[model samples]
Target: MTTSIRGTANADVLTRFRRSAHWKPLEYAFWCLPVLAYFAFPGNYLLLSQIAITGLFALSLDLIFGYAGVISLGHAAFFGVGAYTVGLMGSHGWSDPLLGLLLAALFAGIVGFLSSFLLLRGSDLSRLMVTLGVALMFFELANKLTRITGGVDGLPGITIGPILGVFDFDMFGRTGYIYSVVVLFVLFWLARRLVRSPFGQSLRGIRMNALRMPALGVPVNRRLVKIYTIGAAYAGAAGALLAQTNQFVSLDVLSFQRSADLLLILILGGAGHLYGGLIGAVVFVVLHDQLSDLNPQYWQFWLGLILVLLVLFARGGILGTAQQWIESRRQRTQARQRAGSTS
Candidate 1:
């Protein structure tokens, strides 16, 4: 009974919040909650930084898969290329964060350009296989060239040489977190605009029905190629973000498992929604952190269990579930008020 009362009270508060003039600011505040949490918990700041990068990468995938109807199993190919570009730059003598980002995007774009021919033709299944093959081939090549790629031992000895040669990536993760947040915010702004643009609409139309898009003169394959290139560049930028913050590059960045995990995050959060990637990343990281702290051996099993529950009950994730509950309550309340007035 107490639990039910509290639930009702929470729902009432949410309804009021939705109606309040302060609600708009509060909505923005909600977006910054992760940033606030990072400051609140310094011990977990590093993990948060990583989660943000991964989320951006996943967001790139959502843009393609959910919005553009592109299926890929080798998205990590661009990510790896981005990471390596940064690694290679840092190890040489370059250290400007902004410049490094551009190089990362540029390199990733090149990779996308090269692979788009293979990706542009093929069913979802074929695209998946081809993309997967590309990533795997890249990983293998990196491993084979151990002297340059660092092989299985991974790339180390990378240093960003300080931001603008003044501020360093705070050994405490403060600089890293702030840097990542800034980059993510910029990318997200660009993504927001991209999604609302005419180009974005075309991609959605293509996703809905490639046949219809072309009949309407959308040049379906060309649009797909272009959007896929953009998405790849975004993924690469995400990888570069990680590399800059960590000052290290590893094979794990290119692993099929990493690509698969990003896909899972997208699914867990609901692909078409914007917040899905960010929310999913937070949940995945927090749960992984907590479970690892408790028992690393069984963390995967526990996460698997959570996925099962999410699949069975929460189709839209926590945010989606909350929204549904709130809407349902509003509907019920309005019905009750109408019936009472009639009586």
Candidate 2:
């Protein structure tokens, strides 16, 4: 009877897990935006491709910051590793996009795994400094390695061949935009699955109470390391996508500004939720294009003001606030129905 009870409990847990991972109608609608954009704005393929790449990068950060509770200021270290991996391969005549991405993820994941030990040792502030230091080191290394990385001039001579030997990258950016969107969708799907898994639940527990988690037999450090490595791999994949799409690599890929901007995007979109980064990226990128065009000199001032307002008023961020409002409305409606039934 005890064994049967345990089995039933396990089955119930599994059912809950499955339900949590199930797709929602809103997800279907969210994906439709990308498809609609492809048809609606053929002239802005380049911008749209950029939004996709940035969204992937922000999503990676969300895995670390939102889910794992790891704060990193130098997450671009892995991104640079991935971009340079693809760049170096392309320069050497290895132009296979899939192979380049695999290698990039491998290298970045290794870097992340190795560096994760440092994060385990320090407090949040220390971790921040360590991350920033690692990124700066990579930036300097890229700057000094003129022969290989091409220094400030960027890594030129990166010739990416057709993706799968079928679709060639063109002048109008059609293939690149489609390729980026497809990659984003596949990775997003995988990330969604991961965050809903049992392992992901443990991560949430860790984030909520890291000290209490170990009492439950969860290896906090190991889980953190795994998520950090996974996040690095995701960032690396994003970097690889950017390199493949643009057919170039640059020092800016590892810049602190890129990492900072990514944080801003996450802040604007709200972290924790899977779709937060994507939503944030869309808003950030669109606002940036519009604002920059409107006022190239002081657009940042406006962006900063907007972020200030968001922080002061919307603590949960755009999606988080929206979700809260929806829940409250549903509760109110149920309460009203209950009152009417009593009457």
Candidate 3:
């Protein structure tokens, strides 16, 4: 009787595990799309590479805002810091792309860690103002420090060496695209693991009710600081990739427009979901590319109209809407199955 009971318990555990594993197959298939795109559209590598970098940037934003409920408008600060770190290092003869990426991430992470205290002390509106202020400060600083950042003229003369001393960053952007995609996949995988962990659940709880989290023995502030720092590091790494791939850095890296655009991308893709960033980036970049070519003067107007419609109709963004639709279908099918089984 004891052995039979133990076996039944193990079976129940296995069933629970299998049920929880439903999303894994879908996630794996989603990742495979980029790889397939690389082979299908070889000539569009440069454009695809841009989309990958932008997607990574948006993903970092989603980490803090979507997952941790830390609303920041100055994410571009970390991004600029990362870009400048790589550009300045390359200009000074340390052209190793991998090293530059590491240094950039470290610098940005440190900055995020230090700045997180200020961010943690405020309401959402206050946080927004403070974050925007931080980015503006960085933008002005980069502009004033002409010798290092190159100011309005931009940071030129940046030269990135080959990846692992093997794959050179070619003019065609093949190496750059592959590199960005790989980094994105690795980071996304880590993020997937993180959001599914106990720590991630704590973050979600805090996001739902910060005041109640402290009562539950959750270290709310500490968790926020950690996720913020991690997000900053990811943003920095994305910026470094951009600088290395393009072989240049500009004050635009620190601009408010970049921050705003990133926020838009996150909203378009749907927050609180991992695939939102990737889907939003593809839509935004592709639309921008196609529309600008068609009517550069009025493209912004059309884009704005589209965004207005999305905001009104798709409350959860593209991915969220799609997920909801799929869920509804599954529920309907299950209901029918149950009805038939009863009959």
Candidate 4:
């Protein structure tokens, strides 16, 4: 009986592995796109680097807002925290990039864990207010601490050492672009794994119906706190990457506009999907770049018009709409196939 049960478990594991193997090619292709772009657009590395950072930041917000149903308006608090952590460390002579990144992430995680309690008792609107307040408070605090944070002048003279004791960040941003891409790809992979895991499913369940989750034995508050902290860590890492790549920290990192822009990116890309943040970042950044170049003074108007149309018609943002279209076509094709076979 024991041997038979062990064999059944092995068979189940093999079956699951086989099922998941179908997506391996798609996943490989997805990750390989950045590498292809790296070689294809050598002149556009800086813009690409910025896109990767923005995408990572948006992805962090999606973890809490998209997956856990935690509505926050001050997510930039953690991002700023991470940026300053690296800035201060670099200023004080601990310029090791990898260590700085890890420490920045750790500090941001701690802040998020502490702040999670405040978020637990609020309605979505209240939570928004609380989050915004938290970010504002940090912004003021960073401003006041001029000696350390450099105040309005911004934190200057930040010197980041070579990554992994090699590959220095150069003026053209080639190294930075490759570095940011690698980090984003690794984190994205981990996040993809997480969202496909049981814990991720639980967060989705909580998002769909929090009241129902408790009755189903889910620890709603704990789960929320955990995901929030994880999101904060991711945000921090993104910030750290930005600071290290640029070797500067500014009060703007903690600004309300940063948070709002991130929220807008998520909305534009569509929420509750893993690729939504990345797609949104690309669209938002590229459009902003193009529009601003064309009409600097009235770019906002054009951007607003695009957003309005997107919200009105493409309710699921780009990825969601594309997925729906593809699925519909697939269904129709399958139906035709079945009909022909029957006939």
**RMSD in Å for candidate 1, one decimal?**
9.2
Model 2, CA-based lDDT: 0.93
Residues 1-343, candidate 1: write the lDDT tens digits: 9999999998986675445323256458866777787768887668878888988898888888878988888899999999999998888888787789899999898888779888777888999999999999999999999999898988888878677678788777778877887787788777766766667778889988988777788998888888888888999999998999999999988999989888888878777665677778878877878898898788899998998799679876766776789999999999999999999
Candidate 1's TM-score reads 0.87
Please rank every candidate by TM-score, starting with the best.
2, 3, 4, 1
The whole-model lDDT of each prediction reads 0.83, 0.93, 0.91, 0.91
Shift in Å, residue 89, candidate 4: 0.7
Clashing pairs in 4: none
Report the C-alpha lDDT of model 4 over 1-343, residue by residue, as the tens digit.
9999999998986686557434567567867878998999898888889999999999999999999989889999999999999999999999998899899989999999999999999788888998999999999999999999999999999999998898999998899999998889889888887877668879999999999999989999999999999999999999999999989999999999999999999988988887899999999999989899999999999999998899789888888888899999999999999999999
Candidate 4, position 155, lDDT: 98
Q: Report the number of backbone clashes for model 3.
A: 0
Q: Order the candidates by lDDT, highest first — what do you get?
A: 2, 4, 3, 1
Whole-structure CA lDDT of model 4: 0.91
Best by TM-score: 2
Which candidate tops lDDT? Answer: 2
RMSD of each: 9.2, 1.5, 3.2, 3.1
In model 1, the number of clashes is 0
Model 4, stretches more than 4 Å misplaced?
Answer: 1-24, 338-343
Backbone clashes in each candidate structure, one number apiece? 0, 0, 0, 0
